[model samples]
Target: MTDTLETQPLDRAPATPEDLFAFLDAHGIRTTTVSHPPLFTVEDSKALRGELPGGHCKNLFLKDKKNRLWLVVALEDTAVDLKTLDRRIGSARLSFGRPELLWETLGVRPGAVTPFSVLNDREHLVTVVLERAMTAHELLNYHPLINDRTTAIRSADLLRFLRATGHEPEIVDLGPPSGS
Candidate 1:
């Protein structure tokens, strides 16, 4: 599938953080952002985020055996076992997608992956999966397509934004880590 935004020129540059915020505003998805030290891992976020409240998330850009791309967003603490996640999500084997594919499909690099990047995926080439537990929180947090800032939005607004981008995300109960 040609995974390019239909409304934008093929030569258009990847969306920037500013573009992401503008798109969110255009959609009326209320959000709040805070700038902080660049965070490259969940541990970095925990150390620097001090008092931010919400279900902070980790986004995994994955590719299935069939070459299908997936964006799995789960709580920062969720122990996502790739060995077993495929069965629950109805896919063949799953592996982390490469950085090139991530940039091509979602317009973000590792350490900055966010569901918000789906705005660049106008063709719906990526399957978004939200952890059921994460959605139970009143608010969710993720990078605004960058690692130096975090943005919080209501869980419902997240669903609204994803749908507005033509990605009907799959909310799956990924369950406790194996041997819990």
Candidate 2:
């Protein structure tokens, strides 16, 4: 199964947003799908948002002093303070990871960060985190290994994917942004 996933490449896939959905379905995954324009960051997602049919998500990759890495996914507009997040997560030093690790662990590059990339985490070293508040939403949208597209899946399946990775995520609900 791991080999199947690793060797499978959709590099020449069509430019349509459904590429992610088709990839999931071919693997027997059943989740709702939403399409949107290609995005590089949460802010870049704005223009492609409005018509989106599900919850917006932000995928972050961080590293601690010990060189331990983490992937934190939260609501799109959520304001994340690394200082507070480090304290809450017990990470001695939490800083954004470089693009290389994103590819090493998740088989994805910088702009394509997403929890779904856990599919390629054979070593299972990267930690997963989620802001508690996003659970209130029914579904969430995220990249599917390739940045040229996006995917929408049930909130439960997102959680399931995290668990299936054999890593217990550090979940939190940071009240809100400190200032307006």
Candidate 3:
């Protein structure tokens, strides 16, 4: 007999930034986006993002020893020590996922990792982790599947979007940076 799982078809093509926006609109999730020079780091973003107000964020794509994947979304200034985070997240030792793995799973490059990228993970392979403090902000800003723009959405709307995409994110209080 043939294995039913093995015979299943692959996931559909990944969603583009436009597609993501459309999805949000269809769900009645309001958002605002600003275009600017491509930003590859938090420092770059801070320097160029004039007066945008919100809890700007940084995303980490990680892989644990057991090969499980995680997407961590936190405030740009938050210090995420994988050494301690691994324990709190209940995972084996965690390390940065490779560029290829990031692309394969999230359909985005290193500089464009965002909670929005989870739109591309149709198979639900990554567990999303939201920093508790970050969620306290009224609004959150992130790249919209690309590095050349930033999008702002409500904190409640972010949770709404993630759940809409089949991801019930884990909200964790990743307390102060070590030795702060």
Candidate 4:
């Protein structure tokens, strides 16, 4: 008899918020999600922060001079020197990626960018940058593929999930460059 069962391709289909939860469960990563009004800015999210314990993140979807893409996940209060960030990540020069590209590559809108979105990047086109300090925290919070909710998970589990999605992120000290 021939083996006829075919496994589904993991990266072919875009992942939705629901899919993200299933992915987390499959990886045995425990998470807590809190629902609230859509948050587009850090200030807007502040109201919900008090209820959640852990480090909150602000994710940036950026592109380099060569058109290489990067997803930067940093602590909400961390001061990121964009002009000097390229030196650490080794990108030509960096600027926020176009909204269209962000959606297409990460399957998220502007306010919804999160490291979890790497699951939608079947081609693994976007490089992930994680702030070292942020990862040191016990728990980290980010949107679960959507802006209307926040999901909190163990910092280490976040890395595990990213690796499971084929994105071995570059964990760097996001401290401002010395000369900056």
C-alpha lDDT of all candidate models, in order:
0.88, 0.70, 0.89, 0.86
| Candidate 1 clashing pairs, residues 3+ apart or interchain | none
- Of candidate 4, the 10-residue stretch with the lowest lDDT total is 1-10
What TM-score would every model get versus the actual structure? 0.92, 0.79, 0.92, 0.89
Better of 3 and 4 by lDDT: 3
Candidate scoring better on TM-score of 1 and 2: 1
Top model number, lDDT? 3
Error of 3 at 150 (Å): 0.2
What lDDT does model 2 reach?
0.70
Comparison by lDDT, 1 against 3, better one: 3
| TM-score pick, better of 1 and 4 | 1
> Which residue segments of model 1 deviate by more than 4 Å?
1-11, 177-180
- Model 1, 118-178: lDDT tens digits are 9888768899999999999999999999899999999999999999999999999988743
Model 4, global lDDT? 0.86
Please give the lDDT score at residue 26 for candidate 4. Answer: 94
Clashes of each: 0, 0, 0, 0
Descending-lDDT candidate ranking: 3, 1, 4, 2
**Model 4 Cα lDDT, one tens digit per residue, 75-128:** 988888889999988888999987877776787888888999998987788899
C-alpha RMSD between model 3 and the true structure: 3.9
Candidate 1 worst ten-residue window by lDDT: 1-10
For candidate 2, the TM-score is 0.79
